[model samples]
Target: MEWSRRNIWCVILLTCLVFWVMLLVGLNAVA
Candidate 1:
């Protein structure tokens, strides 16, 4: 159960990182 919880957090963090990168790219494109 602990391992599963940690894995979920890892996935969330990776998703957030990808989202931020995409957001930055979109802003750069607009600018």
Candidate 2:
């Protein structure tokens, strides 16, 4: 159970990182 919880957290963090990267790229493209 602990392992599963940790895995979920890692996935969430990775997704968030990807989202921020995409947002930055889009803003740069616009400017």
Candidate 3:
């Protein structure tokens, strides 16, 4: 159970990072 919780957090963090990177790239392209 503990391991599963940690794994979920890692996935969430990775997802957020990917989203942020994509957003920055999009904004830069627009400008």
Each candidate's lDDT (Cα)?
1.00, 1.00, 1.00
Report the number of backbone clashes for model 1.
0
Q: Write the per-residue lDDT of candidate 1 for residues 1-31, one digit (tens) a residue.
A: 9999999999999999999999999999999
User: Backbone clashes in each candidate structure, one number apiece?
Assistant: 0, 0, 0
Instruction: Estimate the TM-score for candidate 1.
Output: 0.90
Alpha-carbon RMSD, candidate 1: 0.5
lDDT of 3 by residue, 1-31 (tens): 9999999999999999999999999999999
Off by over 4 Å in 1: none
TM values, all candidates: 0.90, 0.93, 0.93
- Looking at model 1, report the run of 10 residues with the lowest lDDT sum: 1-10
The local lDDT score (0 to 100) that residue 30 gets in candidate 3 is 100
Model 2 misplaced regions, further than 4 Å: none
Candidate 2 C-alpha lDDT tens digits along 1-31: 9999999999999999999999999999999
Cα RMSD to the true fold for all candidates: 0.5, 0.4, 0.4
